[model samples]
Target chain A: MQQCYGSIIRRQRHFIRCLGGDRCNNSSSDTLLLLNDNTRMQSVMSRSNPAIEADALSILRSISPTLDSTKHKGQAGKIAVVGGCREYTGAPYFSAISALKIGADLSHVICTKDAAPVIKSYSPELIVHPLLEESYSVRDEDRQSVATVVLAEVDKWMERFDCLVIGPGLGRDPFLLDCVSDIMKHARRSNVPMVIDGDGLFLVTNRLDLVSGYPLAVLTPNVNEYKRLVQKVLNCEVNDQDGPEQLLSLASSIGGVTILRKGQSDNISDGKEVRSVSIFGSPRRCGGQGDILSGSVAVFLAWARKLVDKEGHTLNPTMLGCIAGSALMRKAASLAFEDKKRSTLTTDIIECLGRSLEDICPVG
Target chain B: MQQCYGSIIRRQRHFIRCLGGDRCNNSSSDTLLLLNDNTRMQSVMSRSNPAIEADALSILRSISPTLDSTKHKGQAGKIAVVGGCREYTGAPYFSAISALKIGADLSHVICTKDAAPVIKSYSPELIVHPLLEESYSVRDEDRQSVATVVLAEVDKWMERFDCLVIGPGLGRDPFLLDCVSDIMKHARRSNVPMVIDGDGLFLVTNRLDLVSGYPLAVLTPNVNEYKRLVQKVLNCEVNDQDGPEQLLSLASSIGGVTILRKGQSDNISDGKEVRSVSIFGSPRRCGGQGDILSGSVAVFLAWARKLVDKEGHTLNPTMLGCIAGSALMRKAASLAFEDKKRSTLTTDIIECLGRSLEDICPVG
Candidate 1:
């Protein structure tokens, strides 16, 4: 109950700051960090929803901060990718590295024992943990103990992560998926944001209760994956006609978990409103592109959530993150494709990410 | 579909206001739309194709947009090339990328699922959809369901496109051709213009009902393809002595669908008249030039259609599109040949599309 009122108080403080009350400062002293005067809190609570749409640009600009020397390492973001098994290592590495490239201060990859060394060898910048146990590695008798151990290890650092990207190269090992479910439940309890993609989508579709009604959950599905999702959630075939409206229904049905439907164009919705980012990216249907997208989204989402905690931006932070991530991913893919043509690989696109973000939102 | 018409109306208003009409302020109130005295529409319909022989320079000058900060994304045009397959990725890539370099704001490629990745690898500027299917990929039992899926995928994007350049590198697969036929029917219903070339000519030559009387359908066939069309429609051998008259009859035979007959001097007709674009060109007969011409024609046709919607341009938009496309393509080829001589390839000419257009139609 105290947690509920703390969030409200945060909102009240954000409202005061947004309205230019000038009662707040950059001090992080208060227990709940209320910088402004308390007089506006009652009036703000009296009203229902006080959301206004900025012309789109300002909302994004505000979400992405102007970094300075005053900022610390973790202040920008600490992102984690929770997927990697014996069968796959590249997927988690692509996703984790993408978060760092997109401006996240720290990127961590949680994977199984066999996958950890390979993923770590890909980049020294990544913090790889071999905490997950796949079915082949663990006997059925020890499954319960193993799950408890994995969760305890993850819980130790769960609060430090701004966002967790689930299901990069996460293979479909029954034991692994079951443990991930427990982690998801714990993350939900702590209210950590998640951007689910690839094999992670497979896990979520079957275990809807894991993410159902979780506002901070985001699902990025490819063309085929999206078809399956529509079939399962809407209990009907994917309606190509009225796609935007259908997407809205799907998100609402999932309790407003943001869905970024990846296709010829990207359409995003968080149940309340449908937004799309049609900034043409490279046409390469190469693998690993979606991993890049999930990681980029993780970083952007963390930043937007921070903005929501401090400022009174009414737009859904998940939707905004999807939009920014999609646009930057596409712009970078386009730039990579321009130079390399068909030879443009996911690594090449990853190489272009830093310049691409700088091009879109200049630090200066 | 409404958005397509709304864009035309916006272009009409912009064109009128640009011409110093003082007629419609930027009120966005559309009740005043049909109130433009009905003068332009009447003049356009009464002239009977008015083949007044617009000069080469003027045709291109009016076709290309004058680049400025005032322009919106699709204000220039949005073009899509409905082609590309396992055997033919480069053709669609050349066509779609040419549209972008020629100043179309957006360019897209719709190709077979196998071809999508390859074509996407070519450039990031084009939005590539892996929506098409092939005969080998589909089982006889799944044909119906697959066709429906293909059409639905294309339909969702049909209205957003200003023009579709069909058959650049489209293989002669029966299943793919059948699905494309359905797409043509859908595009005709939506009033989206199409420029047919390469294998598209082969498809329509056998299935005239696909284009039949659709006024916006553009069939751009080479000398050999034009001969087949003439033999199928007119039931006679080519009459070289009276090429223009024969071309006019072929277009008339197809109920006035625009036909751009390629040769040393490009001939265009829409049943009522024959218009020719004569420009000096390179002796190097290279492939992919036709793809560039077809893509260019699609963009020019969309722009010319907007001009007709406002300025009462008497010549059919398809004819103007062909004239402008043919002139610009030949000039670009000539410029590339001038520098590279015998070594000039299709890529060289594509590289010159922007400079060639600017030379003829300066932004200032």
Candidate 2:
């Protein structure tokens, strides 16, 4: 049964690769079949559908810069996560902290005044800004002024950021969401890469214009989020059997903005082509994992962009970023599940991150 | 039992040297043993005790670079720490700033706003950033937006770090812990070396997957931390009688990542072999001493790694790093103990870092 599943996945992968372009068309079924002797490739096919899985580990290694002593601080990457609120501090924390763990030299969080102390109390590791305001806290008369204050505070630090991870535990507040829309606009204007997830997806779904035609925007959506995106973009229900086709249309509809659909395996597209990350993952469907994926994708996207800028267009940095991020997340999740089993939490999967990357690409 | 320990150390050192090549076999083990003898091993097994510790001082002298005017800045080392929070700010400060006093040309600390000022106030030589946030300050409705703010702050300054020590004063607040976890993931993805200690140890313990297979990661754990790690990974209790075997098992279980178990004598293993560091440590076991160890470890880890990379791999950089760090910290503590006795404080020991290092490895 597993072998049969493997064959099906192998076939699908070939099909998708063919769609990818001439680069992948020449390496067809026979070549993949010949490579199947390697247990890693065989195992990839045996479990889940490998065709949708992108070559994430390789992308991760290839994109990872060599560690050198001469480099100054922050030369690797700098990231910001715009989330964390009263009821869901863990989400923003997960996003921001993941950026740091993955090699961003700096990580920051901008949240509400109430969330600041609590988030600050969580750890002195994060720079918590208490600039955001919600409807309940602001008087109706002060709404306009408070919005200005929020944007002004954020703008002071805008140009310094390499990328921003939006939506992790972002609750739905009309006023607060409005403030975020402005922030997103400012990020776009400044040319900072933005990775949208969670409530940010909700906001972007409702107002597609916020990220439309923005090449630096990357949306990481869960099953439900993808469904909403499909409905909004394609005006139709999600067709799982034609998952790649739908995703391609949705991304192209968004004007080439990247879309990473999260699942047992992550499927990513930048309108032109589709890539899947079918690496094994833990069965533990814990919460906050999505936040990790978003944060991770944000960092990789920024790194990829930087590489593209420096290398004068050698490869697709956005696709490479997605592949690396998805693979590392899945690999870590698998390792975490091995230890925690049914009891695994999002934290367990996070701890496995370093080891997972190391397994795929050993460091010296 | 003592002979068994020696054999284990010898075999492991041999393997480490083998990882480097034939030229390193003879001098590397003897020097490493000497350094180990003067640090962790000295305190654990008394000369009259059954287990004889190796000579650690020689190792320190061997690896410690001679001070020469011909050498340029940063040749000695460079180090960074990814930690600090509102609740605790001392960890990152101690870890990064300590590298400077121990002969590193540069040291940097990446922390949240609440902790950055406090940590910076603690020392002028260190570079501190106020980035990162927790949850309470943000409204439930604005988390996604806030997370973006946080990632942007850190993303602005990722990369320029040679090695990062995560989890110093890191608090366990869900929001902050989550962010720290992400930072670890990013570091691994970037292929940077990390030394895990304090709250960082806590993060890794719960999420072993983060550092599981990342060989560049070095985890330093105290007794309770070590106990929990053994229980979680090996699924057993701590065994004193079979310390070396158990340490080996623990390291191997984690897929070859280095583990430095802090006790009277520090035991280190990379799942290959167990080595002991017995050096000149004070009888006084004071609070905040671990901070010194962490900082020292960061410097030595960087230096050892530099040697490995530059000299074509003389030994397992991780192992050599542990040995050198354990020895230096012990020597400094012993030196401080002679002056302050029972009143010895962590700060006093920190003050002795330069002198102790100079005594062992003079730069003249």
Candidate 3:
């Protein structure tokens, strides 16, 4: 725990350096005092190896853009989710609309033709593209051409997107996976940030090279996905004893790609530092909460990158994005739970996104 | 701004002349006094080119018919919305249902065959007619016959409607627009008031002759639509320095048709006078709010027209309708926002319409 606190201080110093000494003067001391108090509280409350908790709310406030009348549509962020097939329309809809509810200027979903109309009907705010093709839809002879067409369609709008969220409702189809792989490569080439979740983790686990060594790529893996990743990369069983150390190793093995390992406490690691957002979340284990997190992460990642690019900030935007996204999703879930209790669904959590964001960083 | 206000008063007098003067004597002084107070407030606030704010709440109260046991089922209003296509079912549904919610006795939706069932499924309150046919459904050889058949279908029900809302989810289809143009002509012949919105605005902007010089026609244009209208009619860019004058000119250019320019503050004009409704409204810019406004406007326009016809009132029914509609929509939006906060969707705002109306003008 002492070593964990030391590492956090070191990371805090780096963040302070990025923000410049003059700008960090006030907040740095306050952050240190908060950390000291948290450490003291942890010593009294717990008798186990606790993961280093992150100041996710502060990170969220740091990255969130101020609402200005001068800023037009698509100025805050333009996020696109590369998912949604015949069987899984709600996942992409949840992710894309969650981005909009979280204050992104525009949210788009690139989905299979069959899913487009259904998703489009869900909300007029989303720009749904009926571009992806599944294996059953394409003949063996036409697979290559269809894949090429899908890539081309997505490529046309690639430059406009600040971030791409992959695999919320993305089903496991070989042809579709091939097309998404090509799309991922193109996004990587253009240096667009990505948040990978659900079946995207499946694709990445099998073909690690798709995201390996990509600093801007963020992989959000739940328990099963994380277990598979650990087995594939570390060639070992899941170790609960040194979870933070393993998560650190897992991220480091992926060549510094950030990993937000979702669980009881969302443990995030960018290899250099491992931080956990153990904030109060709803007990309701809803299916679509991960989709909301992916969407939230994409928006925050884009904003963080914008902040870094515009202000020359030194903090790892990917890590900051994961922390902020996790914290927000948890906050929204808690709020929804407070209202609906056990009946809270993913849509309820999504509806609370804007209010959660406003509570953290007011538009005014 | 003073000159603009003076011109509005002059136009108000002209409208009184059209309504036969005697009924204008009571409300005209009250409105002018409100304008005077607004002018004083504007000077103190150091505002430039301030629009003369209308007392929209009062207009809404005066125009809204009182509930009575003696009144028949359709006595309040019977509104028909001429929209909804394959790609859009929600917009027309929102408009039609909003009319019903805002005290209209009967609400009907004239939509394409593909959209009828879906719009009907949204609510049993709406009378959905899958009468309109798009180009895809009609062959080139059968175009004339199909259009004639569609017109005949709508014409049978035209006289029963108090007012027709001319576009909510009306998609841009050439054949459909042609059929709609024919329907517009028929409605004009019957002297039924038309509240044009969405694709109707698109249709009217291109073929201004469809609604040209029709006093019963009301064009509700949002920011983008308003820009297009200003470009097409005025042949210049939108100048905020002279927004009211430009809006008045735009209305006059369309031959005295009422123009409800929707924005942060809804600006209304009938070529004769300009009145702005800067009442409190939600900051959430979700889609379908325009649909609500169109429906609300249609109902109000019908009631205002009935009031004029029955009571020999001097106020311009169209102007009164726009002001009341704008005020009601804003109030509902504000109320929805207050409760739902950032989670406020168009549906949430629609739910508040009745409560908002009751709050403003309660039924004894």
Candidate 4:
């Protein structure tokens, strides 16, 4: 059912345009894609060198805030996810809600008008804003104004958000990306940290200047996304022999923006140092896990920035966020696997997050 | 083993229009979405105004009809769920199947052609009709004709269904919602009781005339949806300090229409008085539980109306139905949670529905 669900997601990812398109047209291609996925996972697993392992538990304990009775709601962390469209609702919903489940004080989703209700239906815990526009929904003449309105809507709450997790279900639409690019620029000006994953990486890779030299920006790319970034930024293929070195150079080329390359063992680099988190994660490679990672990174990043002293901290906030987030997600996934086994979905893993976090860093 | 497809394509999406369309978009800056939400939830938890607690178990036993060999299939109740789009299929299936499981004689799903097959694949028990048309499927020139044909298809079976559960996985397609609005009008004319939920609440919240003043219409709005409904109808924010009073006023403002405000404890009101069903429920906040509540309410409401002397019963059928349904759903959820713990999904709750209901009012 999960495999069928994964295919359904891939098939429906471009929902509005593909309403009447052939569902089984890509059968042979799907079979090949499945085969390639196996090979790719093995490849990803072999590439990471677990040489310089991150002190993930220590980082998690240090960055996490104590449960204070006096602190008001938003003091813990406030996260906003800029994604979800007519085509994709689950991805953004997964990311935004994961932030809440992992102890963020508040989570928000800014999505297209069509996507908002469905996403909101998933959980009322997240504040959903139906304030985005897609090309098909907007007139050509009204594009400029629509874009302006979209930016204004996001900007209203931009400063209030501790961090933004860009792209969980964000479709690759030209007009929507243009508006998001503008929003990213505003975030840059305001010094808001961003963790880019899923389609956000698709947007950031093509437009490097969006995060280039921005030390606060964190790019979390899965195997394929990492390959694309390596090819695009370094003008070369990924060499597994010197994995950490290649990752360091790629981050260096992007002028020190942190890159957490996701795989069997997650690798992190910010051009200054390289760290790998080799924590045990579940073998169930279900979809929507990346969303969980991105959301986890957003909260931890915010907290890490708050707790870590600028001069005294060994690793930067983004790096610390990636390491802690990676370790927690792995632990949660492992725990979910122990119970659900084959049926261990992203949702199940999400339900384990609080337990996993509490185990790693007990609250007083 | 499964049949799937919803076609009838884009003519002009959202023509009922989000033009000035901030319909569900928070008018209060979204940053305040957190401010109001945190305070309101805490307020709801701590409220102890000596609110009237409904005798839910007594209501359940009173309303439920006894199983007899002489009773025919359709005599129990007929339920139709009007929802499901390309983006969502699980919601309508959950709702329609739930009705059948909880003693409805026949359950039907009236959805877009594309959604019909997927919904059908979920269960053969449901009478799945792929008769609805989305805006994307009908062209501008063809919308009126398509809409008329769509209405004719639904009108044929309108009187047959004892109750219609509007909006479970119902996407926010303008043309689709327009057709649904027309259907709501027809159902109103037939004096068919409607249990409005999910996106149905969205449509009715925007255009209250559809259900306003109709004593048979029941609106089940979750915390956020209830907040929006109050803001729209009462022209004020949700004051958790006066939760029951606010609910009573909101229902009264809509001309005595029943409002089932879903929260920590389900608070119900039909203008005359407010009732709270403070039964112990599951702590797991999974999606699609609301659909189960809507479906359960539809079936119980039908039975309650049948058994209750309209002019003499202590509580109106809608209020009794709300109380009974709330109690049963909570019992089932609690059961599911005891077994599944935090890993419980909506399906888990649905599986518990029959057993839970039997425990309350057993068959001969």
Candidate 5:
């Protein structure tokens, strides 16, 4: 099954190479038309099935930066997870660690004071900051000052991070969410890409303005989260009969921000086109799996953006990131399940991440 | 001797597989009978000498969970060493790092403030908490509040740890011991298993009530510490003539808590059955071997407890933990001795833990 996927990915890579070569010689208008034509061809080929599955493996290969010895530590990528409170530590740890395991150079976690020691204990690889404040910990009189302090603390490291994973285990404490919303504004202002998941989805779903019109923002929502988002944005129930079209509309309604609707087949759309990643995955619906997906997307998104900015490719970086992250997560989960079966957990999938990436795109 | 031990472990694994398959159709009573019968047969076979040695290698294999990709970080084990004061740091580092080398996903050290930086400098892999306080640091008036604060700090993370190894380089400070006593009492209240060694043995020997009726407590005592425990508990001198019986009485007097007596044969008992791990060990009477033993016992104990809890096994997890810990420590020590000979330090023995475990239970 994997070999067949690999062959299809190889063909897609060949097509992309041809497109890149043609763009070098052709006019910008002609190149743009060629890109559209390529997308149309892929859509037609995939029309045999209702869901338009993405060439996720090819997108992953094309965007993954070739590891160079000359490159410095942070050159690979620096990802920060802005989640972790007294109630939730494992989610942030899973996300941050997943980023590092997926080849990010540095992974940081910005969490509340109560969660720092425990999350720090999870892995020494992560740089954990006990900066954020929850409602219970912050008094109403001191909320304004504390919010400023929290934003200032994150602002110092904002420019350095290639991307930020906004929520993994982020709890929905009103005061904490307010501070995170501020952080999101600063990140968006800095033009840094953000992957929102877990409670971040909750935050953005209720207050769409936090991510609306931010092309760099990626919202990854599971079934219930997507339902809530659809209700909030589209003002209607989720239409399973036309999930892709509705997802595309949902993205478009949110001002063209990318939305990756997580399910048996993860559907990603950027209001331009819909893509699905239906590769093999484990049946275990573990809690922290989404955190891993968010972290992976953050790293891949950063790499994809870097590729487009440097190589001048017209690919949708957010869409590419979602496709690659979903594919890799599913592949890793499948490998973990093969070994652990009924006992499969989030950490098992995490351990297989490096091997899975290597299987798809060897470091050599 | 190592080959002989490996064969015994292999045979035991085969037996366990057959028994596990039988468990699907067989009644619980039949399974219990088979378990007891197996234990009895092994005991009878090892009764050729004065000391009844356990099939340590087999016990280690049975308790050691297979390394599956589906397991998360802490699922293998999350151990904490509550030791390392200003005066002594290497012992706690040895204990905590030994746990990681033996396959625990995370290892933490709760030490005195002054010891934290030194321990942290030793290895970035360990999560070191500088929370404990000694007499000189705390004023007479602030002692109570300081103690309370220290206890609270540890209490917050008490539930997350799989097992706690109390006192590897824990100094003999009155104030620190008092704080640790409170921590131990809290751990007992929370039902978190503790392995007491080094200065922890001193604290427990003087104040037996802290772990009096706690079956989850495992006391790992060296020669002098064992002498003190025997004197404190049985109120008598050491008796080599009836070593196993004396060990049994000592453990029984402690209300069925497991005791791993460090010596040539490493006798273990829980007042129920006396099992000695007389596997081939190095002649090196090293200082930090007990710390390694404490750490290894904590991991194995956690694994054994998890297995029993999930699989409904009939064996005593604590006893199995002691046996497995003893066998692996011995095997690692022997391997380290073969390589370094006279220069085999505690670190050398620690470096051998992974290979030693792999030899007994291959990951493949």
Candidate 6:
């Protein structure tokens, strides 16, 4: 009974913070951090009904800072994608481009040298950095020096990025993964939020220490990725019958780090409770759609994180980010599919992002 | 009753063919060819009904072939517009130009030599052919050779053009009109479909034989041109009360040629039946909207033709083409109106064409 009462009080506190009058209007990172911490607490306690879902959306809206003219260039959001290699430039490009399209002030892509120019050719809007060396390009003697250079380069930009999307097109390369692991550790040290996906999941699944116990870290894994994570973390295969319970266990095992499991319904959790976003989405399963989702998550996460810090609102920015990103991506995909039908591509969905956001939360 | 039944049977057959039924599948021109042919039939019959516009959005979706990276350039659709004179460069430019904006791989404009430089200056994307001759440039003695040269030049490119849109900026020059007449004849002989509008409508009303029995000709006439068509084809005045029937009869009377009578509701018919595209359109009354409509029809006709060929469905491709074209044009116009409001121009409407098409048929 004491534990239940404690959970209820925490949820009520989050609800109050969501309604926390004028301070929600500020731009300071402390308020945003508070909001993120409280929202995370509320999500941990309030998971029984659809009202929890409504609460999630409201928290997102509340914490998403207003776009103001006085704000500097990167105030809105500076997102970086730590992915992209040979044969997969389109994924990282899609992820980074999606962030900008969704109103992020700036977006950067940290990819391998081979993938940089190709992703750059896809769009001039992105700042593509060709620093990471893949296994095929690295020599045995030069591995240590190459790895050091990659880490130092990523460290320079770590503080500037509000959020990092760590998967998309990251291929499975031993040298590359090792370097990214270091980058993840440094980001955690700086208290920067991270959303892991794509090949990043492959690395994280093997080296749980990289994200385990890092509260700001977010693992956005699709079905296969989530399955492996569950098996590795929970020591069991997927149990569809108790999805929420398994997800809760997975998040708890990761030491309160957020987990956004992508499926027909996106289930979000951070050890304490689980929330599902099962909004309408297109049935057409074209490739690279997941890249858009990862990119969107990064931007929203940054915004949510900032809002939480500024408001001192006690909610998990990562959880709020997952909900908002899932909703927006689903809405955009539905809007695109309505027009394109079976021919709807990821780019088409990306184009509808602005319109879909306007539809939900009108900008006056 | 017998005659009416016969016409109805023909209309139904055309409708089935347009829907991409078995009968029209194997035909060379495919669904686009069938639609152009059906539109010619509708023009010949000149029947009327206020309510029966084809399901153009669906047709557009059906006919728009899937985009795959494996496919090379020019496999989608290639179109050309024959218009653009010294005084009216923008009209032909609008017509020939909109084709590429809506995803046609290649769009060419065959205009007078004097109009070529200006039209080319408008967009480097277009392949502008400077092969047409105007009366001011040719002496009476050289008229025949000039006409032959123009016809020969157009003929060289005719086989490559999936559809032709005649008369956007075509001036009221007798010599140029005569050459266009010969060009139309060759297009008919080579079984190339034509979408006639602007000055081309003026030429067709005077010398109906250019499209008399050709099943691949479509005439897009505005309020005034429609009036002239009613007077010339049915030897009667415009009857808005029986507009659908009149359109059906007019299409049938011209040997199954299709007629798209543009208005608040775009009325389309072949001799067999009538379909109307009552989709919402902007009230902006912009000048270049008609050009957008003509170019859109060309693309839809091409796409509908291919859809019916591959699916082997029996529905009137002409009706489908008109419906799709009218729906898309209206959607673009409506979207432009929302943004530019009363200040909307043709160029604004043209830009909206892509979004409009994307709205109806996403590139999934």
Using DockQ as the measure, the top candidate is: 3
Tell me each candidate's TM-score.
0.55, 0.54, 0.81, 0.65, 0.66, 0.48
Estimate, for each residue in A244-332, the C-alpha lDDT of model 5 and write its tens digit. Answer: 77888899889999999887678888886777787768755545788899999999999988884444434489998889999999999
Candidate 6 chain B weakest ten by summed lDDT: B25-34
For model 5, the superposed segments whose C-alpha errors exceed 4 Å read A1-56, A65-161, A165-181, A195-296, A306-316, A322-364, B1-49, B66-73, B121-125, B308-315
Where does model 6 exceed 4 Å of error? A1-56, A308-314, B1-364
User: Is 3 or 4 the stronger prediction by TM-score?
Assistant: 3
Candidate 1 structure quality by residue, lDDT tens digits, A33-119: 332423233322333321111123344566787889998898989999999776567678889999999889999999999778667
- Write model 6 residue lDDT over B98-155, tens digit each, in one string: 7876767667888887887677656534667777888889999999988888888788
What are the runs in model 1 whose C-alpha is more than 4 Å off?
A1-20, A23-364, B1-54, B65-77, B362-364
TM-score of chain B of 6: 0.86
Residue B294 shift from truth in candidate 6, angstroms: 29
User: DockQ, in order, for the candidates?
Assistant: 0.03, 0.03, 0.16, 0.02, 0.03, 0.03
lDDT of 2 by residue, A262-349 (tens): 8766888888888777777878888988888887887777778777434433336677777888877888788999998999998777
Off by over 4 Å in 3: A1-35, A39-52, A62-82, A100-110, A113-133, A138-164, A178-194, A204-217, A227-258, A269-274, A299-319, A335-364, B1-47, B132-149, B309-315
> Which ranges in model 2 have alpha carbons more than 4 Å from their true place?
A1-20, A26-52, A308-315, B1-364
DockQ of 6: 0.03
What does candidate 5 score on TM? Answer: 0.66
Query: Distance from true position, residue B327, model 6, in Å?
Result: 21
Flag clash pairs in model 1.
A282-B124, A283-B120
- Local lDDT at A130 for model 2: 66
Model 6 fnat? Answer: 0.02
lDDT agreement of model 6 with the native = 0.77
